[model samples]
Target: MNKKEKSLLAAVVVGVGVAVFKYFTDRPKKQSIKSLFYLNDFSSISKNFSKEEIEREILKIYKEEINLDDKFKAILFLTMIEGIESLEKYNQMAQETLEEYVKQSSKKFLRINKKKKTGRNIYRENFYDLIEATCEPSSLKADIKLGIEECLNGNFKKGQDIFLSSTNSDKNTFVSLVICYFSDELEKLDKSAHKRHVKNALKDDKFLFLKSYIMDKNNMYKEQIDLLNSIEPQNELQENLRLQHLLINLIKTSDIENKNVNLVNEMIESFLSKKHETTNTVLNIIGISIEWSIINENIDFVKKISDMYLQGDIDTYVDCRLYVFTYLIVNFVEKLSEKNKQNFNFMHLNTDKVEILRKGIENNETYYKLYVYLGGETKDISVYKKALDICITKNEFINIMRILLVTETQNKILQSNK
Candidate 1:
């Protein structure tokens, strides 16, 4: 190779930068993004280039139809086009040229900003980000008062959901309760079903601080100390995270800190699985039914709960099917509407629901989406069917899912028999 060419190759290897023109070879010409029109003296870009050739080139760049990874290259091409176009326009008629460019750009910028502010995002809207309203008719205090009133409760499962849906640092304890309660229900069947979720929640980064905060509010200092010990903070406490630390410290210093395990556990669970505004809203609609049931021991509570059971969305409670089973357990004997009564043969599930669920194993895998997403994977109907019977409340969906799998398993069994 020639000495000059060798020098260039050596420079590239050392990561010494060179001009764009010098670095590139016969790869291709580095033209402006806008190729349609010759902003450069048209005759200079190409002596053979007609006005049509220049216009087409400029159009390609103007649309930015193709994506470019090198933004600076794009800016350089755009600026070059802008300067050439402006010069040409001014040379034709200065007044009209300035007026048109200013008016067009000003309108476009204003339109884009207005659309952004109003949140009228057409391209960005999708179900993934859509927030849906949740409802659960059974819960305490947030719906009823301290007095001994007949309060018919609605959905405890939803209460569990409100707790788990949270992901905030301050919501750690709340998230944990939802997980614990659901996990408890899931565990009744097989620990294998919910073990992953439990492990993940335990490993969550913000859990210890949130737990400490909950214990402090519940006047459980010892618990607070335990949670604080669990956390390993970096550097000093952050200004935003200082409250969590302060609460933990307060618990440690409070009187009788040694003797309140029961109160503290209750307090911690309450803090972890409650939502103020949502609970309030839920109660406002169905408070009477739930509160009435609690006060008078009414049979109608069953019907009120049954409708909620069918219509309820388990996702609110970390997608726990236990809530459904738990609800069904109560509503089974509570009292039912005529239609539900006919279908509600499982009313005394203490005797029948388990059998039905047991019988369903022959038709397993018919439960619901909850089993598929949360119950991990299983080929045997035994583990899946077992998951449904023991899940605390409204566990029907997942139970049904597990039971339906029997159809699949049965076919395979028959084929082997053949």
Candidate 2:
């Protein structure tokens, strides 16, 4: 009886051990979403998936993981999406999501009266009031929205005040404040207050560009260049700052013998030597180079850089393109004598180039006036009249009046010469 029992017990123990080891070894390991995506490798990882595919994958992960909360998932999803989408688009979507989350959670916690209406209706009716009651006065999202609204409404002083007063002061907040301070509406603020705000803004390290810009604005070229050199450019912002430094340096040494020209050549060669993955940086370089060429009185160089910009596959904003185009037209007109203006030909401007210039000027009243002025200066009266008609239709009257006055004076001077 002892031998049989011992043998049976040994067999049972061995079988149980085998079963336990197989069960442990064969079970699926719980993979971390973070480890799978590797947030640090976002650009490389995200390029493999389209926006819709990324959205689906994120949803799948969110549903599959019970421990991972919605807020955390949302944050991770946002980080991944940002690598794929433009920064402006990412910021807009993320801010909207945050606003909705804040609104919904605030409604639940603040005990806003639901009345007899359904949840959706109740939220719709009391949304703004609920936000006002529940949002922290210091909330970053709230402050950003408020500041943006104020700026859009042409109340730059109010916007600047809101941005400066933001309790959650960070890089974004400081950036917003700097933008407001630089806006055309800053004229509405007291001169002393505006100066004070600019001084206060220059104190932040993240605002090196703003500080440099202010220095440049005040004609402190050496200081601006020094500040720009002090910055270690890691991204597009810092890179652009470096470019600005180069351009400002060129401007400062314009009167010197060959100094600005040599600097321009160096800048052009430096940019061309690098393999730029981003078109924006390259386009920026080309645009500034064109300006540098004009400053150096190298009309041929201007034409060459303009051709490069027009022919490149760079997808830049309308404003950026318009800035380059405006400079090109201005320089071209300035170089042409009145007798030569009559011989000037618009035939060289191809449809694609015209379309690009038109797209850049569309909806931009200030730019439209500049285009009109350029046309008038070049004796393209037909183009000027057409642009004027469009401006009249769009009710862009203020700049229209200024453009008309300038054009009329120019016409009178030409008539007097005749």
Candidate 3:
């Protein structure tokens, strides 16, 4: 085993040792240590571990938890363990009750939930209890969906059994999706026969991205960046489809902003210097991050954007930068005051496509603003105090202002009391 694996194993031994001591020595002991170990009492198992070793033991417990002998229970355990391991990054809400112990669940994938605390995907008490309970076919359907999502994300082995065990009627699309993701081509069992599968075949972006991922796993960086910039004027086919490769690219490039792209200054200028810039949509959403800002002289850069076409021919514009600049300004700036933040104004900036931009910004701003409001920064109200939630399903993030809203309401209550 590698050094890291060795370290993890060492930790598991120490952790389990302590937990056994605690179970035997602590007062009010309910169950026997042997019984817990046999039954995969991982929560107790976890207390014995430290660091990543906790995750290692969880994986061990997980293997014992699943089996074809008890197909139904196995699928539930697999899905539940997946959520615990991943903290549901690939699949949000996979384990609703696994909050506290998730600190060390999936050592790799990270997810931010409504609580905004970065943690693991532990099943806590829920998954174990569920699997031990009598679950129906429909309940199995939910478990399979979760498993299928994970499988789509490259966890094929566990996902496949979940597919095989779940009732065929409920999991047809998911089964088809899982099948397609693994590139499993069974004999001509009427590929076109499964409507849900066909539908997933038609609309799912994750499935499409998976195919692209497997075929060209290497050198995918540049290709995916090119794809994210290509999101536009796509029919229903594109709408449901995600440029996940691009999304990953964004995540990687995202933190670079705080570090400063000094060497790439010329590239930065060149990006905005395109003739048919396609709304300067060429820029990654990461470029106009919620963190940084430009100077006032550059504030009028929105005005210089006038030399191009905003929406190209769609909206009659001599310069596209006018609309694109305005969109970025509205997003990056926390709040805009008609009086103070006056030099650069974008609301209703376009006579023709103004409404379209307005609505798009509004919807996105609802969630995005919350991000800036919470741990993010924006001096202006444009960046209000809002809490953001991660959308693991869409592989995107959203802000939840409701978190701070309660705080505001509480403030009002205090003021009224005063």
Candidate 4:
């Protein structure tokens, strides 16, 4: 109980208190930096950090990786973040480092090689593989983050080019570019080269829907069917791909040129044979197939789809709702017999379902034209005006065309009647 012993005890207690305070204060700061180690983590930089802090932290992690491949990937991730030009300095640093590494590696290879000139070509191939072929497939997911911004802006061509230009482009980017190609946003390229690229992209199992869609688009149904037949489905998803392939084949090969009713019935029967669990992809195919049937005047197919609609087989899917609405208003409803018309009118009775349809029309640009066309059928000038206003606000050319055509046609008919 002496004064000296009490002073020493107080000093020990104060030292421990300071150390605990320091640990608590520094822990979060260290954790915040450590949490941003991976590319995916870096992709979602929080607003808590300034742009400069993110750049500094990213560079710190990039330098710590100590290997050329890892460093390059980290830089590539930074470059893929949209609208961040400040990070390009890091990309230049990476490029310079890569150049120096390649020079040193080439020198080492040349020293042991019998043919120096051919060794250079071999080195280039290895370099390409090192940067691209050996990188993790998800590295290109960063490119998708940037490309999505362009896609959202309706600059599909720019999005496609961003994907195409990425050295680490993988299945995701390839599939995204395929969507751009189908949209006719991409500039014309060599068709054989494009097909070869598509074939390579289709080898990824995740994009089976894209594979079927491509086959349908290109009228290469026979080739796709043969391919699907060769590979036994490993899972339920693969099985669905096979079913979609067969359904598309039936639609593609039908004698639609001659208005063959039997063939139309056969197609409808084939589609309905598989009680498909309405996945988004399956629903898309259903909508597209029914659209084709409608365009070809397949009344039997329309009736089958209408029956499915009434049964709520496809009530949840946006694509099914869209195409079914289009079919009913344009081709099916007016042609229905009195009894069928009564049944058809029942679809309008579901207030909740009608709300879903209205929400879909409000949110989806694809639905706008169909909504305008339906408005035209009603001879509602106000609906046409509403559609035109929306098209103008969104700068939707196709929707504008639909609105204009429908309005003018209706006006001409009214003039004739008067």
RMSD of each: 27.3, 27.9, 21.4, 25.4
Question: Per-residue error at 371 for model 3, in Å?
Answer: 10
lDDT of 1 by residue, 140-163 (tens): 223221111110011333434444
Model 3 has an lDDT value of 0.38
Worst 10 residues of 1 by lDDT: 125-134
Best of the two (2, 3) by TM-score:
2
Q: lDDT per residue, candidate 3, 187-291, as tens digits?
A: 223445443454454343433344333323333455555544554623322322232234435444645553334323333344346543332222222234212
Candidate 2 residue lDDT tens string, 1-418: 5999999999999999999999989998644444444343334335555676666666565445544224333444555454555446545644554444433432222111222221122112121221232233255376656875565433456666776577644334354335533443443456665555555556656445555656665566776767767777666545754775667666666776467667767767666554454344345556566666665566555554444444443244433343445446445645766765454333333334444445445424323544554564466555555444433112232344334433543343334334
Q: Which ten contiguous residues of candidate 3 have the minimum total lDDT?
A: 121-130
Candidate 4 structure, TM-score to reference: 0.46
Q: Candidate 1 — which residues are off by over 4 angstroms?
A: 1-209, 212-303, 311-327, 330-352, 355-418
The models' CA-based lDDT, in order, is 0.36, 0.50, 0.38, 0.51
TM-score of each candidate?
A: 0.18, 0.47, 0.28, 0.46
Which rank order by lDDT, best down to worst?
4, 2, 3, 1
> Pairing residues by index, what is the TM-score of model 2?
0.47
Candidate 4: residue 330 lDDT (0-100): 38
For this target, which candidate reaches the highest TM-score against the unseen true structure?
A: 2
The whole-model C-alpha lDDT of candidate 1 against the native structure comes to 0.36
Please report the TM-score between candidate 3 and the true structure.
0.28
Q: After best superposition, candidate 3 residue 165: deviation in angstroms?
A: 9.6
What TM-score does candidate 1 reach? 0.18
